[model samples]
Target: MKITLFEQAAYRYLPPDFAEHHDSVCDTPYSLVTHDGMYSSMRNFLDELMFGARSGFDGIAVTEHAQSSYDLMPNPNVVAGILAYQTEQEELDVAIFPMGRSLGKTREPVRVAEEYSMLDVISGGRLVAGFPVGLSYDASLNNGIPPIDVRGRFNENLDLVLRSWQDPKPFAFNGRYSQYPQVNIWPRPLQQPPPVWLTGVGNPATMQLILKRGFGFTFFGFAGSKLTAQRIFPRFWELADEAGLEHNPYQVGFLQHIAVAETDERAEREYAEHVEYAFHTGLGAIPPQMLALPGGIDIRGVQALLRDPSDFGIYWQMRQASLRDLIDSGTVIIGSPETVADQLTDLCRQHRIGNLHALLGFGSMPRELAMRNIKLFADEVAPRLRNLWQGSGFEHHWWPERLGGTLRRNLGEKVSA
Candidate 1:
């Protein structure tokens, strides 16, 4: 299994009473921020990523969010550039994954292609590119995109970006959302195209798109893994089976929050408060309407959600949840090295996940505690989980080639543009 350290650059100095007076996204008061607090949040984030790289993580990942106290990064590529060059100088062979620019939110598709190509060049071909369809609020409220047109815009922008990277010569292009007299980009990716990944919640259309087009699929367990994994992952592999594709585990990636200490009791004592802070003030505090704006999810998706509502897991009750509530729901895993390793291993084995994105720093965790979590995870927990798929007769087609990822040029039938 490929285990990477993941973190959101959350402003860690929110007052303990933040959830009562403020939401985490879009309209959160900037007056609540101190210069030192903002600086420490961002500075510590970068330092911890570098620390993970040095501590032998297979990769270090960051994500993009805008107008949000939970994640300060509006553009992850800027950070990716810094890590690309820094890691190169330090000879750290880890992948620099900005998981990454959101397509539905950007008007400049070619610029996205160009920036990714540059990072691949600067990092000597160690970039794993990720493209997320913009979050509803991030696209519409934060960037002024019409919610109804977000997915349409995402499809068009993705087609343009892929062609921008792969087409050999300048070509005339006409697109529904964008058009250009001649399409060309310099510094095409060092790996033809660095392996592509898309993030999703359990959307079958998105799952079909990833499988048909030979792209990697990543699922975030912010809604709680145990509650949603059985529903989401099986449906994904069932689609692969329907398409006559082998269930190659590496094609799937999962992101989960984890905290590890010397023992389970100490871990709860140390991390319980911070874990509560992460969910209550961060994800839980974001208004539901912001996540599901009009025309964001398909009508069928919304209807299915209304019928079952199991897909959202414990999200509806997260704001007032205690540490025990979080753990019981699998929103975050906390324990000793052995306990964390055991739960993660079983989760991956049952779900057939070959890539593990371990979100080690979150909520209002202090710098020292976050660093310790990263260190302990890398040193103890990760080693136990790395060999889960060693002899599975499958190659990790979703990873960068420089990092022992084997390329499989054809995965299944291509999705129509």
Candidate 2:
């Protein structure tokens, strides 16, 4: 397994009763955030990502969330640019994995491609580009993209991005949502094309496309691994089997929230409320309506989700969920190093997961505790888990070439515009 550091730039100080008074995203009042608090939260987050790189993480990952009080990262690439040059200058071989610009929500698709290419070039060819369809609230509420058009836009945007990366000659493009003439970009990525990754929940259509296009499929386990793994992973492999594709574990990645300390008791004492704060004020506060607008999910997807809501895990109760509730539901794992390691091991083994995005720094977790978690996990837990899939005989095609991935070009599909 490849253990990476996943983090979010969350506002560090919110009023204790902020959750009761406001939602955490889109419309959270700026007045609730102090000027210094904003600066420190952002600065500390960047420092921590560097710390993770120096401390021996294989990669550093972050996603985009605009106009959100919890995660202030409107564009993850800005931070990625800093990481790219810093890590390169330091000669750190860690991958610059940005769950990059949301295609579905972005108006300028060419800029997105240019940004990733530049990041890869500066990082010496170590870039794992993540293209998510985008969160509903961020797309619809913040960017004014119609919910029904999000997926369609994602399809077109993704095709344009890949073509822009690998296409040798400038070409004209005509599309429903985007139109470009003489599409040529400078300083193409140093890796021919850096590895591409796509994230989704349980959307079968999304999974099918990820498989058909031959990109990495990542699943975020914020809801809770135990609650979601069985439901989502099986469906994924089933689709792969149906499509006559080998079940390469590296084709899949998972993200989970984690915290660790000297003992289980101490872990809870240190991280419980922070974890609760993450859920209650961050994800929990995102109204369900915002997650799935009227046309966000297809009719069949709606039916399937309604029939088996277990894929969502503890999200339904997150608004008022306690720390014990978060732990019990597996949404946030709080324990000793051994306990945390065991949980992660079992999770990866059971799901045949090859990429583990260990989200160590999260909502309101102070820098000291966050650093402690990163250090202790990197020391004790990551080592035991990193070798889980090494001897499994499967290749990791999804990782960046500079990081030892034997990447093949789009499964031999031609780049067309």
Candidate 3:
């Protein structure tokens, strides 16, 4: 399996009762932050990513979140650029992944294409580009896109981006959301076109798009792993089967919040407060209306959600959730190396996940504690799960060629069973 360390640049010094006083996104007051505290939070986040690279993680990933205390990154590509150069200089053969620039939020698609191309060139063909349709709050409230049009805009921007990278000749492009006089990008990605990935949250339409377009699918386990997995994974493979597509595990990736220690009790004792902080003050504080605006979701989707809101497990209780709530719901996996590995292995094997994005840094966790989690996960847990799909006879076409991956040029290309 391809194991990556995912880090978010969450402000680490929020007051104990920050959640009670304010929301985490859009309207949160900046006055709560000190200059040095902000710098330290961001600086330490970068340092921890590099620490993961050096500690033997296969790749290091970051995400984009704007006007949010949970993740301060307005553009994850900036972090990816720095990591690209730094990893290349240090001769670290790890992938530089940006769970990256949101297509629906951006008015500039060419710039996004240029940035990914440049990152691939700098990282020496080691970019795993992720394109999320975008969160409702970020696109609609923060960037001022119509909530109903987000998916349409995302579809158009994605096509333009792929064409910008893959088209050999300069071409004029015309589309509903955007128009270009002449379309061409310099330093067009190093791996022909770097592997493409899309992020989703149990949307059947999104799953269909990922499968139909031959792109990788990433599911973030922030809601509740056990709950989401039961409903989502089965439906994904079922769709693949209906489409006559191979059920290659590499095509599916999962991002999970994890913490590990020498023993389960010790892990709970050390990480409990931070885990509660991550949920209560971060995701838990964001109101549900902000997450899904009235026009944001399709009518069918809205109806389904109304009937079965089980997909949003633990999210309703996140604002005041305890450590037990996080663990029992499987939102955050905390335990000894053995316990963590066993659970993760079973989850991946059962769900057929070939790429594992381990979120080791979160909440108000200190740099030392985060580093220790990364080190222990790398040294103890990663090795145990690396070979889970070793003899499965499937190839990782979703990864970079510089790594052990065999790139798939198109959806029609056969993948090994």
RMSD, every candidate, angstroms: 1.2, 1.5, 2.7
Instruction: Estimate, for each residue in 1-417, the C-alpha lDDT of model 1 and write its tens digit.
Output: 998989999999999999999999999999999999999999999999999999999998988899999999999999999999999999999998888999988888889999999999999999999999978899889998888888888888888888888878898878776788988888888987789999988999999899889899999999899899999999999999998999999999999999999999999999999999999988999888998898988899889988988888889999889999889989999999999999999999999999999999998889999999999999999999999999999999989889999876543432336
Local distance difference test values of all predictions, in order: 0.91, 0.89, 0.91
Predicted candidate 2 versus true structure: per-residue lDDT over 331-366, tens digit per residue = 987799999999989988888899999999998888
Model 3 ranges off by over 4 Å: 411-417
TM-score of 3: 0.98
After TM-score superposition, what is the CA distance of residue 99 in candidate 2 from its true location, in Å? 1.2
**Where is model 1 more than 4 Å wrong at Cα?**
410-416
lDDT of 3 by residue, 267-371 (tens): 999999999999988999999998898788889989999999988888998899889988998999999999999999999999999999999999999999999
Poorest 10 consecutive residues by lDDT, candidate 1: 408-417
TM-score of each: 0.98, 0.98, 0.98
Please state the error at residue 241 of candidate 2 in Å. 1.2
Determine which window of 10 residues in candidate 3 has minimal summed lDDT: 408-417
- Model 2 stretches with alpha carbons more than 4 Å out: 411-417
